[model samples]
Each structure stands twice: as structure tokens, then as C-alpha cells.
Target: MSEPVLELTGLTKTYKPGTPGAVQVLRGADLSIAPGQVVALVAPSGAGKSTLLHIAGLLDLADQGRVTICGQDMTGKSDRIRTAVRRRDVGFVYQFHHLLPEFSAAENILLPQLANGVGRSAAQARAMKLLDRVGIANRADHRPAALSGGEQQRVAFCRALANAPRLLLADEPTGNLDPDTSDQVFAAMMELVAGTGLSALIATHNLELAARMDRVLRLENGRLTEITGQQAGAGFLQSD
Candidate 1:
């Protein structure tokens, strides 16, 4: 079998540790996402889901744990090495679009590739392809402010995928849109993922959205529990 795209073992994190306001967010949380699999992470706000993703994406480090990406262990790696690995192997999206207001959608996607050393002409072609994949080829020249909410998010999705990373980490990628727009944007995202066959771990509160993924994971009290079969529908309701 192919090695897992992302792995977290014994991940533990504490905010304000050893202080009067210490809070432990993760308690030895463990997860393994195989290549081409899409996993949904469901949790309430302040439930440490963002922390988990940050750690997984190498944006932050855990107090005690190991993060392995594409078969490489990231324990105690230098910031430079971590950044390189993250740029080469991981893509991240958040609730907000966070696109540059001044840059066009295609430019936003192309910039990352340029930073990663791709030539301008090739990056431009790749950008248009990604925008087309997300059903926004015509909006490629429009800035974020000119696009609709769903269009902006779709551009953000393309930007996140510009480098063709092996793993995608998203925290509520569609949380800001209306139900209809969210569904549409999410479908585009899934199609993009399916086309690339990259592993994705998306955190979302929308149970309906979570149920569509290959697996559902509930994160509570800093630990993760897999929910499958009928439980996928009924289990998330308990959080409400």
C-alpha cells in the first residue's frame, strides 16, 4: 500500500502551559489519512480543530507528538525544512477567502507557483486550468472584490491547490457562504480534489458536508473518533 499522505501521532498541545490559565487542547490525538482519501473533521468552535490543522500543516508545532507527511517525520525539523516541506507537500484553506483584493483571481493562483519557481508562462496556463476546473475560467481576470462569495472562494480553492501539494488541510472552507453557494463551491472543490487524487482533511461544522467525505471524524476534548455508517448522520447531531 502507498504510504499515508499525512500522519499525526501522540499530538498534544497546551496553551499558556504551566500558567494560571493553562488549557490542554489536544491529548495525544492520532490520525492517518491515506492518499486520495478525503476526510472530514467535525467539531465545534474553540474545540481545537484549528490547532490540529495548523500542526498538521506545519504552521505550528505540538508540545509532544510526531507529524509525518509523505513518509517524512517532521519531529524537531528546522523551520526552513518545515517550510520547504509545507510548500512542497501541503495546501491550506480557511473559512475566509483571504484573497488579495488588488490581484486578479488568476494572478492569486499564479503567484504561488511563481514563488515555488515555476515560469510565468507555465504558471499562467496552470492558473487558467485550475480556474476552469472550478467553473471560474471567465472570472480569472476579476479581483476578489468583483466576484461573488462563491466565486471568490472558488478562486481561493484554486490558489490553495496551485502548487499541487500532496495533502490539503482546510478549516471550514465553505463556512462563509450561504447554503446554496456553499454546496456549489464545495462540489467544485470535491471535483478538483478528485481530479488531483490528493488526500484532504477538511474541518467543517456542516454535517451534511461532512457526510459526503470518505470518512467522518469527530474531534472532542482534543481527541478524534471516527464515525461511519448510520452514525455519520446521527452522531454529529449530539454536538447540537
Candidate 2:
């Protein structure tokens, strides 16, 4: 079999380690995600789900562990190298839209590509195509302030895909949208990822949405466990 797109071994993170207020968030958390896979991460608030995502995405460093993305060992890599890898191979979406108010939807989507030195024409073309794929081509020229929450989120989705990342990380992506809009956005994102065969690890509280993913795992007591097939079908708790 091919190597996993993402791999974490003995990952651990502690805040204020060696200080009086040190708190351990992850205790040897381990996980592996194959290319083109869609995995849902379910955990209660303050359960360290976001912490794990940040570490796995290389946005934050683990106190003790290893992270390999696309077969590249990230351990001991410099901040610059990690940042480059993240910009090139990882995409992130947060609960909030986080789009710049001054930029148009298309421009916002093209920002990352431009930052990576993609030509203006090529980046714009790719951004426009992503916006079209997400069903928001008509709103390309609109700013975040001019769009609805769902539309803004759609724009953010397009921006995340602009880099053609190998791995996508989403934290509570649909937490702020209404049920119907949330479902629609989630479906659209999944469809796009499926089409591109990109791997994704999403942290979400929406059990119904999580149930539809290829696999589901729960973060509890600082460890990751596969959700039972029955529980997956029944859906996880919105609160837990």
C-alpha cells in the first residue's frame, strides 16, 4: 500500500511545561490518514480537538512526537520549512469565514496562491474555477461584507482549495451556519475534495454531518479512538 498522506506518532503537547500552570493537552495522540480519505474528528469543547488539529497541520509544534506529511518527516524541521510545507500541502478552514473584508471573494481565494508566487493570471483562473465549483461563481466580485454567511464560507472553502493542498483541516467548519446551509456547504466541500482525491480531517460537533464521513474518530481523555460503526450510524452527541 502507498504511504499515508498524514501520520502522527506519539504526539504530545503540553502548555507551560515546566511551569507552575503546565497542562497536558495531548498524551501520545496517534493517527494516520490515507490520501483521498475523509475523516471526522468529534470531541467535546475544550477536549483538545483544536490543539490536535493545529499540531497535525504543523501550525503548532508538539512537545514530543513526530509528524510526517506526504512522506516528509517534519520532526526537527525549521519553522521556515514547516511554514513552507503547510503553505504547499495543507489547507485549513475555521468555524468563522475569516475572509478579508476589503478583498473580493475571488481575490480572497487567490491570496494563498499569490503568496506562493503563482502568476496573477493563473491564480485568478484557479480561484475563479474553485468559486465556480463551490457554486458561488456569481459572487466572485463581492466582498465578504456583501455576502451571506454561507456564501462567505463558500468563498473561504474556495480559498482553501486554491493551493491544491494534499491535506485539508477544518475546525467546526459549519458550526455557525443553519442546519440546511451547513449541510449544503458540507456536501459541496466533500464533493470538491472527493473530486480532487484530497485527504481531509475535520473537527466537527455536527453528528449528522460527521456520520456521513468515510470514518469517524472521537477525541476523549487525550487519546483518539475509532467510533463504533453503530454509533457512527446513530451520530455523535452535539454536546460531546
Candidate 3:
């Protein structure tokens, strides 16, 4: 079998450790994502789902744990090495679409590929392809400020995948939109993920959207618990 695309073991994180107002967020959290599998991470607010994603994506270090990506151990690695791995193998999306207001949709996507050493023409082609996948090809030349909320988020998704990362880590990719828009944007994101065959771990509060993924896992007490599709709708309730 192919190796997992991402792995986390014994992950633990705390805020203001040893202080009077200290908060322990993660408690030996463990997770693994296989290649081409889309996993939904369901959790309540402040359950440390973002923290876990930060650690897995190499954006933040865990107080104690190991992160393995594409078979390489990231624990104790140098910052330079971690950054290289992150830029080359991982993509991230958050609740808000943080696109550059001045750049066009295609430019936003092309920027990352250009940074990764892709040729200009090649990057532009890939950008168009991604935008097309998300049904936003015609909006490629529009800036973020000129697009609707759904369109902006679709651009962000394309940017995330521009580098062809092996793993995608998203936190509430469609949280800011209304239900109808969220569903539409999410379908586009899933289509992109499926077409690329990359592993994704998406954290979301919407269980209906979560259930559409391959598997659902709830984050409770700073740990992850695999849950059934039937149990997905009740994830937030059970996490409380």
C-alpha cells in the first residue's frame, strides 16, 4: 500500500504554559491521512483544530509530537527544511479568503507556482485549469475585491492547489458564506481535490458538508475520534 501523505503522533500544544491563565489545547492528538483520501475534521469552536492543522502543515511546532509528511519526519527539522517541505508538499486554506486585493484571480494562483520555480507560461496554464475546475475561469482576470464571496474563496482554493501540493490542510474553507454559497463553493473544492487526487484534511463546523467527505473525525478534548457517517450530524453535540 502507498504510504500516508500526512501523519501526526502524540501532538500536544498549550497556550501560556505554566501561567495562571494557561490553556492546554492539544492532548496527544494523533491523525493520519492516506493519499487521495479526503478526511473531514469536525469540531466545536476552540477545540484546537486549527492548532493541529498548523502543526501538521509545519506552520507551527507542537510542544511534543511527531509530524511525518510524505514519509519524511519533520520533528526537529531546521526551519529552512520545514519551510521547504511546506512550500513543496502542503497547501492551506482558512475560513477567510486571504487573496491579494491587487492581484487578479489567476495572478494569485500563479504567484505560488512562480515562487516554486515553475515557468511563467506553465504556471499561467495551471492557474487557468484550476480556475476552470472551480467554475471560475471567466473570473480569472478579476481581482478579489471585484468578486463575490464565493468567487473569492474559489480563487483561494485554486491558489492553494497551484503548487500541486501532496497534502491540503483547510480550516473552515466555506465558513464565511451563506448556506447555499457554502454548499456551492464546497462542491467546487471537492471537485478540485478529487481531480487532483491529493489528500485533504478539512476542518468544518457544518456536518452536512463533512458527511460528504470520505471519512469524518471529531476533535474532542484535544483528541481525534473517528466517527461514522450517521454520527457526523451529531458531531458538535457529542463534542460538547
Candidate 2 Cα errors over 4 Å, as ranges: 234-239
Model 1, residue 31: C-alpha shift (Å) = 0.2
| Model 1 RMSD in angstroms | 0.9
**Local distance difference test scores for all models:** 0.93, 0.91, 0.92
Compare the candidates by TM-score and give the number of the best one: 1
- Give the clashing residue pairs of candidate 2, or none: none
Residue 15, model 1: Cα distance from true site in angstroms = 0.3
- Which pairs of residues collide in candidate 3? none
lDDT of 2 by residue, 1-240 (tens): 878999989988888999999888889899999999999999878889999999999999998999999999999999999999999999999999899999999999888898999999999999999988889999999999999999999888888889899999999999999999999999889988988899999999998888889898888777888887786656544435
**TM-scores across all candidates?**
0.98, 0.96, 0.97
Candidate 3, residue 214: lDDT = 93
What candidate 1 gets wrong by more than 4 Å, as runs, is 236-240
Sort order, lDDT high to low: 1, 3, 2
